[model samples]
Target: MKVQEIREIIKLVDQSNINEFVYENEGTKIKLKKTETVTVIQPTASPDVVQGNAAVEVKPAAPATPKAVEAAAPAAAVSERENLHKITSPMVGTFYQSPAPDSPAYVKAGDKVTADSIVCIVEAMKLFNEIEAEVSGEIVEVLIKEGQLVEYGQPLFLVKPE
Candidate 1:
């Protein structure tokens, strides 16, 4: 079956309270099971099939370790903090660093920028938008490449406090 069909079936199974479901259609067969603590497991087949029978097993009791969860939590927190005060795109558009092809880039990494400095340009619906720096600081990073597509709220740079 198609991936979309499989995804739809999985979604349906997740919404219902069925504990186990098995279906056979022509040459394809699928089995799904849900426990009191819901966990979905993908099926696997062994190379050697004895007596033309395949054994299917589900292992769903595995829980994430505390260390793994703790590691992930810090990463999420760091990303959230880094993205603060981001100069996001006002509209979906292609971003540019220079006013024209032959001109120099408006701003570079480590450059001290202010609220009035035009940091980049965003071309949206055939109009070029002069994206300005909304805060004053030394640029720590540039998040987008020149001529890349930028969406609304996409970060353009990271600024270190001056």
Candidate 2:
């Protein structure tokens, strides 16, 4: 399915009681399961999924299903997360942690970074786009791995401001 359709499915699933949704057609399979967060898992075999061709006929459980009520995060954890600086993707592309396959990653957890430091690369349309760290801090978390397809504005790293 197209990225937009997948996004829509994600929204629909998040707003409803559906914890898992699967769609299979034309040798393509799409599965979305809600974890601690809502994420869209890519179809494994679909070469090109057209919009309105997914043939998704979902009958979600009632909106007020007991399992749909997620537990809220603790106040301390939420406060800590709020204080961190997030390095987000500027565009949709594949995330690359290192310059080349054999090279070490630019930064990892506990690494200190400056505003101009090259943190990673995102390859889009055969062009490798070097992503920079816009804030100076110690890398507290690397939210994405190499070669993962990331969406625009998705958090890549969480930095503890220095």
Candidate 3:
């Protein structure tokens, strides 16, 4: 499904009372659920509250100027990382190194891969989705640990092209 269409569906669900919705087209499927939460603010109704308020007001204000942080030497790392290609997550999910927990990992650092290689699996909503390498290269780094929560578009691996 197109990104615009998915965004539109999300908009409709957000404005309505619907808590859960699912849409499927061809091989693509999307599911969304809204969570309701309650926030409670306590009212201060005692003399102690007023005393605490007074104490807070008596404290000096902080300086407006922000402290400058030391800049790291990033030229070499930046250029090297930029030259290497990346494989990123297609959706938000928990990353798995193998198809099954007991199985050996599909790929690792220094391993060579092709465009169609099944490098990893991402579990979203209890569904296991195999992720492809999409480019032929030698994997330079495995960016995520097994069972890590991966965000959409987050880099999963770095590759040095073959």
Q: Count the backbone clashes (under 3 Å) in each candidate.
A: 0, 0, 0
Q: Is candidate 1 or candidate 3 better by lDDT?
A: 3
Q: Stretches of candidate 1 above 4 Å error?
A: 1-84
lDDT by residue for model 3 (13-58), tens: 7687554555555666666555443232433532222342122111
Candidate 1 residue lDDT tens string, 40-96? 454464243233355433233444355445465587766655555677776556899
TM-score of each: 0.51, 0.58, 0.57
Candidate closest to the true structure, highest lDDT: 2
Per-residue lDDT, model 2, residue 77, is 76
lDDT (Cα, 0-100) at 100 in candidate 3 = 84
Higher-ranked by lDDT: 2 or 3: 2
User: What order do candidates take by TM-score, descending?
Assistant: 2, 3, 1
Q: Write the per-residue lDDT of candidate 2 for residues 1-53, one digit (tens) a residue.
A: 56567567667776776665677777866666554343344444534334675
Q: Lowest-scoring 10 consecutive residues by lDDT in candidate 2?
A: 59-68
C-alpha lDDT of residue 100 in model 1: 100
Cα lDDT, model 2, residue 97:
96
